[model samples]
Target: MANHNDRSGEIVLAEDKAVMAKAAEWLREGRGVALSTVTRTWGSSPRPPGSLMAMNDQGRFIGSVSGGCIEEELIDRYRQGELADTLPLSLGFGVDNQEAGRLGLPCGGRLQITVEHLNSVTSIDQLLNRIDHGELVARQVDLGNGEVRLLTGDGHPELSVSDQSLTKVFGSAWQLLLIGDGQLARYLARMARMLDYRVTICDPRETFTDPDPLPDVDYTRQMPDDAVRNIAARPRTAVVTLAHDPKQDDMALLEALESNAFYIGALGSTRSAAKRHDRLAKMGCSPQQLERIRGPAGVSIGSKRPPEIALSIMAEITATRNRTAGVAAT
Candidate 1:
């Protein structure tokens, strides 16, 4: 497992954010810097699909796109001043599919990256500030001409702004959808926030009435079903139901199970989980769908305490996400 403090190859916009921030500061200190982003990738590529790294003229570097496949060449470009143009340029790694095996990428993945020269105006300081303030921003970087524009939206790309062009969104890693307001939920929310997951807590009953206890979570009194219905789960979102009641957990699970959420889990015990499944079965959920419910939702580490259980659950969720990313890379 990579240390949380180590930023190498992290699937975080903040990692790149800090890199860009430091690069801008370096430029202020009279250092020229260039930033490279992996805008699109296909088949067996390393790193997340949209990872960014920056390099300064002094040969200092941060972040990564591949498992060291192109980092050396990028550093060389900076050293020799090969990339002086401000426009974005595309570079390919490995080989074509027919010759992929010989080049080392078994699946023969190719990546299209955009590298831009960073100056005072073209820097991402304002964009990074917005993301730090918990705002989901969409940045349209024209690959054809290398112009970048920032817009504030709910983190979804709109229709193509122009024909025959490329646009990308860069901010935050993913969102965490949590259902329940118990002490466990509070702990999980705090931990998830530290991991940079945007967390929303849904519980209409107001079981945990005091809002001050959970300042980091976005508290909502909407019913689980209604709340789940309100947000469209994406491939980057994780949904977890901590409320023990079937009435609360079932509806949320039903809605989440039908979505594209990367992780869908609920809290329960062996006997309790079996009963929960039986109730879902009686409620007309098919066996295949019932299997989608990850009950006793954590790795088997024998954690009985609330905080430890939350840790285990978060660990499971993160591990699931990493495994999914690795599969996508391959």
Candidate 2:
């Protein structure tokens, strides 16, 4: 496939989400490419560690590890074909403390980039194929000599890895679990679809109804608790209970807290939430697990309507997905 600029580089996250898929597609079409990832960062970094950027042999690139500070430089080097035989290289931009002041970004931040060559055996196509199957894979980068390696980590075996400068490889996919079939849940479900999350909604009441224009979401008419009983939760998964019924919300909350899901929240008022907490406590929930639930869900966006509240909820979920501290719901 010839290099094409899909304008995806303009988006900080679009590139991150699709780079692996795009790289895999290119390699499958007989094109060569390389990937670079920022595995670690310190103090006020532009992108967190694990941020990735990929480039085709023709110098077409997607994704960014910095806020446009280093892509142009990397592109120039890539187009000139300087990295083809460098034996996998880890390059650091921004000079040392004194020189950093001369180059800007002197705010005392560093960017470490690892460049790796792509080939048939190293086909990101295969890697992404595994990811599509829901497995977790890790890419390990040997910093001393730039030897890119791939290994299957514990848990999901269907995950894929593409970056070459990885010192450690871990696999995770964000999950968006909605515990209601109400209009608000439908709205949130649509937004979550755009965010590339696997969405599941559980509603026991047929009267609660199905959303007319639902996105590609998994729907279960089973009782919320029973619907979620078999699914194993992980840190990447988020469970939001919006079903107002205690039986639905309480059961899902209890099960979610017992699992590995990182963001567990419910939709209710302070008084209602307090009551729910007391109920859960009476049901034997510990204080620590109860603390994990964000009742009266969503950040304080001053939203009074369902759509606006949906936006607030999405914002909090996005922050949680990005590992950013969420503003408490007030």
Candidate 3:
């Protein structure tokens, strides 16, 4: 299957990769292109502040800046030759309820859209290269003249827009490391990918782990503690022990709790979780470090099966990730 997200189903948070890649493709195929970004929004909006969409002269497109209507308007304008002359065009929609209704925007919603005539081919290639290398970066555009800059560093997944330019990040935003490769771990891996998380499964015990490995996830035969350390101990990463055994779970927990991973969770019953914590305490873990472990590791969803439990754990993980990023969970 074809995928636009850089190396689709392999990595996470290449949200703009699809749009950017499609724009590059159409350009290679000799088509006029216009790129748009939702710079600002107020009130109820379908897409968020940093949403992106790219369209070509043939009215073909990828990604979206709104639920649907905004793309239609931009495509219609492009087809009519009304967009090319005013290259770095700024337009507004849904200024009022009446306008919102006519444009199919949510009531009281307003979107500040900046559309640019595409020209920076080399910049797009370089941006994609950086993303492939896993460096957090942003592509900023000068709305006045279409100059694009690829900045290096801890780029946020959100966008910041001023009247003169728009800045947006593209790269891995979150990662999930599972300490086991059991059936539940498989379920969690798939579900986590659906949420755009780079997923990895680590289990040294081949006989103990699931025999069938998922193709998209990175499967490692490393010991649990080493696996925890192997991943970047950053705030955007999550470590969860789904092995349900002290041998595997505790090793991961010891390393994960000491690291700065945004979410650290363990799968088990309350009694089992308490025992795991005590076992770690005897192994020199401080109370505060032990306190950080989410035992019984999930929302209280009364989950009793593999998929349901995975869902609950992901819910807790998602909430933690959002909070760590200073974003409200919707």
> lDDT value for candidate 2?
0.68
Instruction: Give the whole-model CA lDDT for all candidates, comma-separated.
Output: 0.71, 0.68, 0.78
RMSD of each: 7.1, 6.1, 5.0
Runs in model 3 lying further than 4 Å from the true structure: 1-15, 42-44, 81-90, 95-109, 143-145, 153-157, 162-165, 278-292, 324-330
Residue 286: error of model 1 in Å? 2.6
User: Candidate 3 residues 9-100, lDDT tens each?
Assistant: 12222267778888888788888888888777778878776677778787677767777556677788888988876448888877467767
The parts of candidate 2 lying over 4 Å away from their true place are: 1-17, 24-32, 40-48, 67-69, 94-110, 120-123, 153-172, 324-330
Per-candidate TM-scores read: 0.64, 0.78, 0.81
Residues 176-238 of candidate 2: C-alpha lDDT, one tens digit per residue: 888877789888888887777778887777566653747578787877666666553555678
Model 3 pairs whose backbones collide? none
Q: Judged by TM-score relative to the true structure, which candidate is superior, 2 or 3?
A: 3
lDDT of 1 at 31: 78
